[model samples]
Target: MSTVIAFIVIFGALVFFHELGHLIFAKRAGILCREFAIGFGPKIFSYKKDETVYTIRLLPIGGFVRMAGEDPEMVELKPGYRVGLLFDENDKVNKIILNHKDKYPDALIIEVEAADIEHRLFIKGYVDGDEEVLKNFSISPKAVMVENGVETQLAPYDRQFASKTVGQRTLAIFAGPMMNFLLAIVVFIIIALFQGMPSNAPILGQLTPDGAALEAGLKEGDVVYTIEGAEISSWADIVEIIQKNPGKDIEFLVDRGGNTLEIPVTPEVQEIEGRKIGLIGVYSPVEKSPLKAFVYGFKETYMWTKEIIAAVGKLITGQFTIDALAGPVGIYESTSIVAESGFWYLMRWAAVLSINLGIMNLLPIPALDGGRLMFFALEAVRGKPVDRNKEGLVHFIGFALLMLLMLVVTWNDIQRFFL
Candidate 1:
């Protein structure tokens, strides 16, 4: 696959899954998610529903879920949206007035004259306000079109994020990372059981009839211990060496009944699909049970999460350095290589990346999910939220520093991978 295509899919899926988590939790907690955008910067395409603007932006590396009153700078705490219009089964003008009286309890109803409102439906709210959503807002079938200017009112306070309890707010913040973790587990489950994972032992499950293995004196059920003096842990290691050295002499170390034997064999040079490749003529067994796959998938995600936490701990203790980090460029290059390997390989790598993203977001660093959770935890103890300006200043500084670090790491990755 083209590196660009690989980069887009990998980045898009990971980021979309992460943002979806926050959006779902926010809606559940009665917080208005104003926008759910994939990527950053200028939006290329967008659609609005339930007061949320879903969009795909220009950048492909990251995404965001914009909630009302969550970011004090971007959104108004009492921003109002025209959700639904009042309509009546009654046909006359008095019916419309009665409909407004019965349905629009909080809205300021206004009548406007229009040039073309015969049999057509249109509901106009605030068309001049800077933040008013005016396009595609009406859902009524029989409501007459209001072409003239109309006044709108503020939305209910209960619908804004700032009005929610601290616990609910914390859940919405944490949900983004939690969704990433769930994505990893689901991806792993499908790949591990259905696509089948590489056998750790790489034991030969069966031999071909008079094929390369039979001619080379290799028997079935042979446990491949090493190849070319390198200890073998999985079938992937064996395939890597074989594919690279087609028709070349291979030294295999196998354990048969506690006896170590060195077997020399030459892989068959096979020409297919305009490429010269090596064929070992043996198949490895695979795990195919759904229940077992689920169990192992969870275990794999847990282990990966633990590894990430350990890496972070090491970095904190000066045992690890910034050089170990992989920026966007590094991820793109790695994804390209994995994509070339096969579908299963890419799936496994994506799962690992998802788990890594989830774990990273949970770190108690400023401007991250865990950082907000830290403040929330403090609020729970102190019985009051921190000062908004102070918290915003800290996050602003942290975001700046993070962007700087990203630039440095991206430069390093460009030097290592591209240049």
Candidate 2:
């Protein structure tokens, strides 16, 4: 139950901040926001304020911003030329006509093609249906050769996206991730000022009898400097490095009597509640300070982000297995352990998680803020936006892929925990 609560708190805070970023920006930009919802599935509670509906749903996983006309497929376009084009059964070359060609001879011709085209031509020319002129002209021509095929109609609101200036659209898209970063910073500051900071001291305060440190000639008063040739600045660094190298022989540099000596220790394999961690019979000293606390908090947060990225890279390179990845269940268990340990420990974990959340959301993957930002960047570079349907389709596919990944990770977490 504690683990579940911790998970809820962590996930809810992160998601709220993420969606809040979009909501705030949308309102600031004068965009019509129809609804702001937290969670998915059926809405348990809802309220309307200032023409916006706010909803709380059954699940506490994440939230979303529902802006007006967010879905291009559902948008109704105003009546205009209403030019319709027909394609073959396979959506190949079909027929296209301009309803009011005489009144708007200079108007640009927009063509919807079945397959994606790399380069497009937008030139003013007459279509004689000649192969060479059609190829050279800047006009897009749908090959309307077949009948009884799917018909695609161009809506007047197709220009809605292209009509917005680059800056406005960019801001609208970037607002989500920018809010995540800001929320992370704010959470860090709050935790830093209120909860204080946790420290990992290298001094060997507690040692188990006949343990690795004792067996390796490490005394209680010695200050550890390095492990396995890697520089250890704090207790956190020592714990992280040692945890990853369980049951492995390691070299340690300790300071004793104003003399530095190297000690080789083979950590004992210890099972703690079905999980394996290297046991060196050592305990890190806990320290707290006002100035060092805040600085250290930020540094620790930054380091956590770097470490996660490094782990991901290593996993991709086959240095680690996918089983190393953790899902919500794993996080909940870890959070429970931290909470049980003490307040300082919980604060440290929270800080680390916050940083991780901020960095992960910035990845250039679909269904993430980074991916949307990438699309915006492409639009800015091309001086035109991608087709809304196409872009939406890509994001939909991405979201499906991400959900599949989550399911796999969750399954792994369950197997590791119970099986």
Clash count list over all predictions: 0, 6
Q: Each candidate's root-mean-square deviation in Å?
A: 11.0, 14.5
CA displacement after TM-score superposition, residue 96 of candidate 2 (Å): 34
Best by TM-score: 1
The positional error of residue 291 in candidate 1, measured at the CA in angstroms, is: 0.9
Candidate 1, superposed: residue stretches over 4 Å from native: 72-154, 198-215, 219-284
Whole-model Cα lDDT per candidate? 0.73, 0.65
lDDT of 2 by residue, 106-143 (tens): 43343322222112412222233332342222223333
Give the number of the best model, judged by lDDT.
1
Find the number of clashing residue pairs for candidate 2.
6
